[model samples]
Target: MSEAPSASPHTPLPAAVPPLTAPSVPPHASSALLASLAPLLHEWLPRQRWFAGKGRPVDRFTLVSATELMPLTGSPGLLHLLVRAHQPQTAPPSGSRGAPPPADCYQLLLGVRRSLPTSLASSLIGQVQDGPLSGHSVYEAMEDPRLATLLLERLRVPGPLGSLRFEKEPKADVQTGLAPRVLGLEQSNSSLVYGDTFILKIFRRLHPGANPDLELPLALAQEGCARVPEPVAWFEGANPDDPYEPYTLGLLQPFLREAQDGWQLALRHLADGRDFTDEAHALGRATAEVHTALAAALPTLSLGRPQTELLADQMTDRLDTAVQAVPALLPYAPGLRRAFDALRRLSSAGPAVSAQRVHGDLHLGQALRNGDGEWSVIDFEGEPAKSITERRRPQPVVRDVAGMLRSFDYAARTNQPWNPEWAQRCRAAYCEGYAAVSGTDPRTMPELLRAYETDKAVYEVLYEARHRPDWLAVPMAAVQRLATT
Candidate 1:
């Protein structure tokens, strides 16, 4: 491990954005229609976990295009919209204006149709009812059930939909046993389990390029890494000319049905007072092997000497932001600074290992313990909110180790009602395993662990602050412990 860099100054900032407001998409038909439908979409978007702009203000709305997928009566019509929302532009204090206002945009696949005129337009837009839009009317409309069905049908099609076509292969017709069952967990992507054998993850937000989950894992698997779920196939259009076009909609992969998620498994072992040293050791060895394999499979990148210095720099930057956001972190500033300094010193004490491709997000949730007693990894999506460029960057293998270590802490803390020492035992076991396989020195483990732990904890603090403030204690506690230690 290399030495970490110095801590930067803290700067307080305001919230990223103001409270979310209802969007206004001018109806292509009439103002009356717009008034009736805008609020409906607004209410629906927030209710969906897959809506990326949830809780953010919709500065403006523009409907780029709309398409109807089915009939409105006996058959359902799926309404898909290319919508964009504007956000306040963040600029530096200088004279030059900053980049354009941040735009939140995505394709909204809805089920809709013309509703009959009643005493008045119902306050609800996509609500499901026993009858039509009105008690006496013959027409009815909905978004969820209709759209979901259309998505399912399209997925069931032998090849891609619309201009997004797939190459015909002899095995293309081979039964993948994919019976799409919707998963309740997601914020911006719709997930369905196909025939209990594979999962089709439909990305709600459109982007160009191949899906990372599809691309990276296949590479890793080809490199003989067995940790990730095998990529069975991907859904994307062959055409490249369409912009604002939704392509590469989903991916199909073997589902690890019999295995317990690593997080839950760790918690169970901790609660039962079952020693996790062996398990952690296994995980560590597996992780090292993964790193070795990744290095061999992907191109190696170089970063200057004393890797510890680089580690220290990353830690300092994260800590600086954390201290500013949560003033409670100020007291630990000196200790954090000292830790980085120590890390920097240690970097020069050893030879630099070549940087390799690594799992950008490696946590307990990313792995499963199969019935056969082997660990399998999943979700190569790599931080859904980050850009493709950032996700593809090369980094130290220790960064992944740090993520796993933090995950152990998370598992322990989350299951504290069952066992408090879960994190400690698991951490020890995992480190021991990693050391055994990587031939890493025991004496050097502390600083490396500390730097990585601190880095991960700091990330968690920010993550929790933005996404789930209620869970802030997990990372905050870790930060306090690291600072004190």
Candidate 2:
């Protein structure tokens, strides 16, 4: 372990270069063992999609808890951990406020083996030397079938791992000894399919309270909503911050083996030059059905003029931030502000609007089309950037409506000849279908819907700028349209 060498001013440095030694490790762990693994973790973490510290160096790891699941028995040993990762802090921008807060807590599962098979080489985290685990190759356990199966087995039978508790919902029957296959497309969490009958989603970043992903769906299931997959079993662990409330770690639900994601389905229709209006209409009805069920099951509120003004202010603030991050939005900022202004004025002129929990982040990708051609909404995690508190707050249902409209526009614009007319048809048809089932037409609230759409487009602009520079044009075009029309 040595200090990182200073780079020359003329040379471009990589965003993150791990220090020779780990900044910190589990307090109670064998110092030598953790010391040996620290360097490996520093290098392995940033490469993972679920790691929050992308483009930032991992300064240290503070262990919340660590438990050996199953020690080596001719195969790899299993270890489960909840660790807080601290990234290197940078000074705030000029004229900004206090320093950025420290990092997030993440779940880690490690497989310790003497040597990895050639097939498992890609999963290697690093090797250990001169420690309790010396001469072992430690890799992510989720990648190893044996370890993954063991995790499923733990959930199949109600059990406890140290402070962590695994429990099944009443009436849930999870089959044991099912084969596990890792899902590769997940970004923020790891999911495994068990025999194509059930899927277990392991939440990587641990949140203090109950995650809405599980809470909402479990409620929906109890309300007899068939549009969402119900949680069959879940796992949680003791939270030091709130001893009364445990941190949700993972959820198991029935797998929709015959379902196709709506994004792909929309793309298929676009590729065939076929109208997606019918499917869009059906999806709208499904969305309305879910909204009704949620309203019936959860607390609903009314956003009075003052609250509406505050909401508009928040939208304007978000626009200001997006404009700052994506300078291309500068030209449209004024027009977008006007939309929010209109919303504020309109709200003051009318009675308070009903507010309830809607899908915080809704898009085509969040919907799935079953083999029966019915649409099912999935992933109630909300916007990843929003805090758990903000996401769980009640909001106007039109927010979800606006999100879906924007997604339809995205589908149209992603193709050549950018068919706004097609998007218009689908959007109108969707609203019509929704109105038929819900008895309230989203299109009737023109000003509010416009404002939400503008907000969503601004959010998309910033997102595309940061993650997919090539896709930046898509949202930018919508921003221009919103600003002018």
Candidate 3:
């Protein structure tokens, strides 16, 4: 693995734009081929769960690169293409009626192809269309499973194309060909765990900027930050204009083989009727250590009122959308408004805290409790749907702390089947931990916590409404609690 980039706080930053290339073939491929493949892509993509935009049309298709797997037994001259598709940008038609404009961008589609297998015709037929393709599909040859095996083998092989550079050599023996298990945790990206020892995250959305998860953790690991997975190799290319642009398409990292996630651990403690004070205190100290290390390694950037104002505006917009999506939430709009107003007031308080770089998305799921009972964080990728520009911006550290706190609340509520008193105990433990390391007076900390928590709750309301309507109650309940307290 290559040495991680230097940790100097003042290093010049790279531009966020991704390299672009013109289509080799005409932008639109023949409808015959696309129609044949659309249904396969659509069905397969949604099933994979790693596909970011489930149920949405894959608007554009570009085959950036392909590597063929072995031939099928019964079929001659047939090959499988491990194809990558580029998402296109388009606008909704102007002056359209109540119908919202069409999606502005195409979705990234991964294509798998082979001669049609005989027995699976029913599963594969009729998914194709006439004009533009309606969905994405995969064509597999029946005579041989070699193509599928080969694809899996290639993913497991740590060749130059798949290998990532790590700051420290792995303590565990690094072996290839672990059975790949697709994790069901993510929405926008596909994550495959290899042999329960390493994780390979393939991004579905193509963006030009360095993935913060790929870059930030690597930087922190290089600086001896032990609270996150150690940096490993990232899959990137040198050519910016090639169909395969120079971006972190995938990342390879060590997996916490025996560790439970922090959220689960907290819930476990709560279930056992154990006080979370110690764990909370440890978390606080660990978080403080991470912040201190981050401050040392990266330059502190200015965060002005404009940024806060923008955040407030985003919260407002999300609330409006949420109310429209779930009219049930309408009755709670007054409480939601109060929360938004509080956020705006805090924003207008005028730069009480300096903006420094922060974990774009910090929550319990992003952390793991290792076998040794230590906590390690992962996934620095910001909100997956946001633009790279937004993900890369500097923000207050309290935002991250707020995320962690919200996660504790989520763990408690979601795991109620296991522990009834989980939420209250976990919150107490986490707050105690945060207070110890933050060194802020209790009075001021409450203000910061309230502001951050309210901000996070508003985001949660929208996120849950769109993706997990069942969980919308989690954020709504938090809003009610916040308003009362």
User: Evaluated with TM-score, which candidate comes out highest?
Assistant: 2
> Which digits, one per residue and each the tens of the lDDT, describe model 2 over residues 1-485?
22232222223223232222212224555455566777888888888898876878888877776666665433467777787888877666567786576478889889988777765778889887656787788888887776777677667767666667888886888876577778888888899898899999999987778888998998899899999999999888788778877888999999999999998888888888899999989999999999999999999999998999998998998898888888889988999899999989978798788899888988899999997889989889887656678889999899999999999999998988788888998999889889988999998898989999999999899889999999998988889999998
> Runs in model 2 with CA error above 4 Å?
1-27, 30-33, 72-74, 90-100
After superposition on all CA atoms, what RMSD does each candidate show versus the true structure? 12.8, 8.8, 10.2
TM-score of predicted structure 2: 0.91
Residue 124's lDDT in candidate 1 = 30
Ten consecutive residues with minimal summed lDDT in candidate 2?
A: 1-10
* lDDT values for all models: 0.61, 0.83, 0.57
**CA deviation > 4 Å runs, candidate 3:** 1-39, 55-60, 67-186, 237-245, 346-351, 415-422, 441-443
- Considering lDDT, which of the candidate structures 1 and 3 is the better prediction for this target? 1
Report the candidate with higher lDDT, 1 versus 2: 2
